[model samples]
Target: MQLSGLAPGDWVTVQARFTPQAAFLVAADGRTRTYAEGEQRITRLARALRQLGIGRGDRVALLAVDSPEYVEVLLACMKLGATYVALNFRLSPAEIRTVLAASGAQVIFHSARYQEIVDGCRLRDAIQFESGYEEFLAGGPDGGELPAVTNDDDILSISFTSGTTGTPKGVLQSQRMIKAITQSGVLELGLRPGDLIYSGAPLFHAAGFGHVLYGVARGGASVIMPQWDADLALSWLGSGRVRHATLVPSMIIQLLEHPELAEADFSGLRSIMYGGAPMPTSVVRRMADVFGCDLHNGFGAGTEAGGQLVLRPEDHRRALAGDEWLLGTIGRPAFGCDVRLLDPDGAEVPDGAVGVIASRGDTVMSGYLDRPDLTARAVRDGWFVAGDLAWKDQEGFLHLAGRADEMIIRGGENVYPVEIEDVLGGHAAVAEIAVVGEPDPHWGQVVTAVVALRDGHGTPSAAEVKEHCRGRLASYKVPQRIVVVANFPRNPAGKIDKLRLRELLAEGRIS
Candidate 1:
């Protein structure tokens, strides 16, 4: 039977029964578990959770890094028909309190490292992963039946936004959404059984959680990295055991800069999957040259929607063949998704016209938890829109035009920062660049470029950077002001914090 037809929680049983002894998890610290062992532990954990008074529809929260225990807790929630809430570990105490208060989680599991923080949250029961977690798991009776997963629409997890623009909203992730994403990854992204995968991203984020689940969903093994380390990752990649891996642009950049790039044996590596932010074209090309493997880039998949658009490996090959415009696109609609560019009136926009993205699919979240008003505004009919803007090319590929909220209206003309940033980022001296609109007296808003130059490259004056964009972009689209910086401020989600950047500039922190 297809895994798509079953609840995501049942995927473990399918793999465990069929693949039994196959490795399900391999931690960076040398911890390992086979499918049978993982299933047994998950079953016990489900019963243990029941003993703690957590049942159907109840919420269980986790505040920790990526680990096998994290994966087990998520599965345990699924087995009991409970909702798992993965909170960001990087959040401050106040922010953490805000999320906990909103989520109303019955129990929170934290690592020893976060015991102090969890104590401040004042939960009724805060189980430490290493200290009390094992004891808690052992408390369950050996042979008890878990709840049946009957409803596909049941909330499986609550994923919070990165809070770049404002307070984080809890996006309800359903079992159906997880199943859809799992099927999409297996069919569209070529995830296969027996493929040893490595995903070091934080489990709180969708990509991190999805990558970890994909391995179990496909009867493969996932190599867990508690946190990303370039040196440790390069060694894992060279082991000739890891077939698939998930990384972000920043992680890839660090891996490229590592001295082992030239010596690492990636012969067994089949694909490199990256997402969460835009990748510089230069870095993309360098990664392709160094890794010599299939490159997959996911685009437009947020907490609300699991998988929407994907730039497949073949798309990267085409870009290498001089179809450079393809690199700017996020590829076509993903499997089982309907992606449309719509005007304000909800009508589909014509090709080549910039419009807001509206997606409808099984992968779309059920709704925002406890915010029906906001949910109504975000999801109309069956389509979900989150203010992301893009234009469809003639070949049906979509090129991002920045977020609708991030668009700059310069002198009444709309200017997308992505177009300008892409041109400036290709310059040899620039390592990373961000374009934002600054408040202006006459023009209402002026385009400003914040750039971080590569090492050994002398700083280019504002005029020189502007000159590079002269013919490549229209005069209105060109940046009106330039500010150089050593690095950018990143939000908890690892995305460049443009909102914070604007704040810093207004305060005269960056010149």
Candidate 2:
């Protein structure tokens, strides 16, 4: 029952031996892979990788969308003891080349859609998933002896940080981090053998990709979606095909806004795990009314760390009933994660006092790839601090303030954008909201709010938006200016690109 000592490949091997007929993967296109087929395919892929001069500690990169092949490549790398790097398909060719070079990838596997992009790059080897993948599988036998992965501390993969704040850095994901994260997810989400879990998150993201591996760890099938489509997702959930699902807040909102939402049957769902952004109370309540299943709000941990906290289903029930404030919190520390809120001096902060969120656990990554100095700064005394700021209330729930870098300073007073966004987002007209500080000679930085209005709602004037936050927040915390946009630019992971917004503001493009 314990999965702590197993390598990533061992997770598959165990299931193949014990439950060979169980479904391991259900792709978006209706392709299915049983545990036996998965083990054989992975073994063949590992052999193919070996033929390409890949070995232990070697780097192999994959640039593609979500597919059964993505999981195969990762597990093959694990079996070969090579390091896997999942390149973001959204990145431009120039950026992709840069990341490949940084990772020292010996070979690159990409889908046919990205053939031109991969062809333009200078790599030792490139295999197209559409044309070359089957041929590549033929390079090795269907099933054979594979290299053993000996060390738990060995790097299994490298996940890049979403470069919203700055340039992306490779976060080393070791076997230990992967196992710990998968175990935590299995326990917290109540995953069971043969369960059909669905997730819309891409395979490249650490958090999103974990769902794929979670299916393997728990002897279940992961229903993979190539892209986020609200209607398609509703149909799948309505048909009673998926027992558990993972989604973000935006995806949830989209499902709620769908024209056929009322017709969708979600009674088959056992639980819904949501994270990557905060959800509005309206959306949460509405979703609860529709789905009527457990809503788990997973929070914290960047690419450098795994999950830190989880606002469980019980908390959501309580918040929906009477204790509404619990909806604003990110719940308590997750299983096996030691979360702490520390001051500038690395001391724990008093209750209700804002401090940097720090965590120490097996889920934390080994280190940033080839950036020991940055790694040393990020991981101090075994705790990973990523500049996320939060405060623990008297009841032990943690409330997010904002990132240390994203905190707005106006007139020498510190302002957290989350507080302002939470207040203004409750407005009848606001569908999405982001707060940023615009440069002001008078106040050092002026608080600015950018928002998208709800469909079928009239535009709220800047004055009206400001007034909405006036009584809910402190005087200084209220937005000095409000700008309404049709939609905000988002990063690959679907987070509002504040860094991009700041750039547009500086160029006078967003005014």
Candidate 3:
């Protein structure tokens, strides 16, 4: 995959010239665009943005739901060498303002539904999707020369973190990073020409954008879902048009619970890639039985780092056949990436010893935008410390222990939540589980389990749940208290929000 002189936007132009009539983007509402058509639209948008005084290094923020226009604006920014900032639609006005101020975005492009939010944020030079956006494009010359974007080091996008722990920081991604990610996707995810990729994940995040970019790089068509709808997803799968797709565990659970899943035709589906959370082994097996397609579980790559590791389809098969333990592994380091398990002092830990997960590669972000101190702390000796605690197995598979920030100290004993969650997740009654440390006057922090029971199953007593883990986990790791909920609050990326669970517990709401 020679990517020289081929930024994402430049790749789009190349695809258009070579496969003019090939479908490039299919919107959720049935609108479709060929590669040639998408290129023209992007060119016009780029020209309009340039006319508005946005050029190389200028920050352009977008606050909207997923749509073809969202992708167009992203490509437009790439074409004009402007750094694109994708604001999470679920963020509060204050949070949005903070990110905008940090990025110093010159203009904000938002959907009509977000007009009030955009107004309340008081963003300068905002363009509304309904009329202002079209009018803005109409005012610019469509065929004008775009800014030369030859430098691969130019910042391409700034993706904000999920802010689960604290305020989200803007991750500065360069053309080089995106290109590396695109190639990783092609090589690892099996993206190829003629494959129709369907992605419902929010394009504001790296996972979603990587999906779209992979399809473009492979000259494949992509179906963009504005939002996840289990019924609509089933319909698309049954349509036999979608060859591959990426989904979160929550979405997979919904699909499994949907009534139409049994009747959905998945014979044409080639691969299903899932991540964003730990998946239950039972659910993985059920998906394989139902779809009869390859199931891949992966982790590591986030906004700061591109795809770093992948548990390929073959690994899933191995787990299914009896090495069920492999399902828990995040697989080996991806191509062009180097992963290490390091101690606090930055020394490499021996294999099979738990340590902080760190990676260094072409796909890693340049740095956190404008946070030199944080950049220095996160990227040391050219390696980006992921803050995730994991140990490499003898087989070279990386097994997640938990986030270092989420580690629980119970009666002076260090306990990783994932260890308890993994044990409890296998219980028949538990559908979803998140373990958190609740401040305790005696023990410093008590191990608390917040659980959501599987549908059609009654909630098991806290004692029963604790007894199930008695043999599997250390005594200190067992949940001191279990609180059952209807559902776990999730971040935008569909990962369970442990922070929110702690808040609910503190508020006496989840008891």
Total clashing residue pairs per candidate? Answer: 0, 0, 0
Give the Cα-based TM-score of candidate 2 against the true structure: 0.97
lDDT of 3: 0.85
Q: Rate the local accuracy (lDDT) of all candidates.
A: 0.85, 0.85, 0.85
Candidate 2 runs further than 4 Å off: 144-147
> Per-residue lDDT of 140-222 in model 2, one digit per residue for the tens?
86555454664788998888887888888999988888888888999999988998988877889876679878888889998
Candidate 3 Cα outliers beyond 4 Å, as residue runs: 121-124, 144-148
Error of model 2, residue 203, in angstroms: 0.4
lDDT of 3 by residue, 1-511 (tens): 3575666778778888889999999987778899898888889888888888888999999998887888889989988899999999888878777787888887999988888777776455999877687788777685733545748899989999999888899899999899988888888878778688987678998888788889888999888887778888888977778999888888888888888777888989999989888777788888899888998776875798876788999999989999999988888898789999999889999988889999998989999988999999999888999799999988999988899999988788889888787788888887778889999999999998888888788877767876887778877888878788888888888889988888988998888
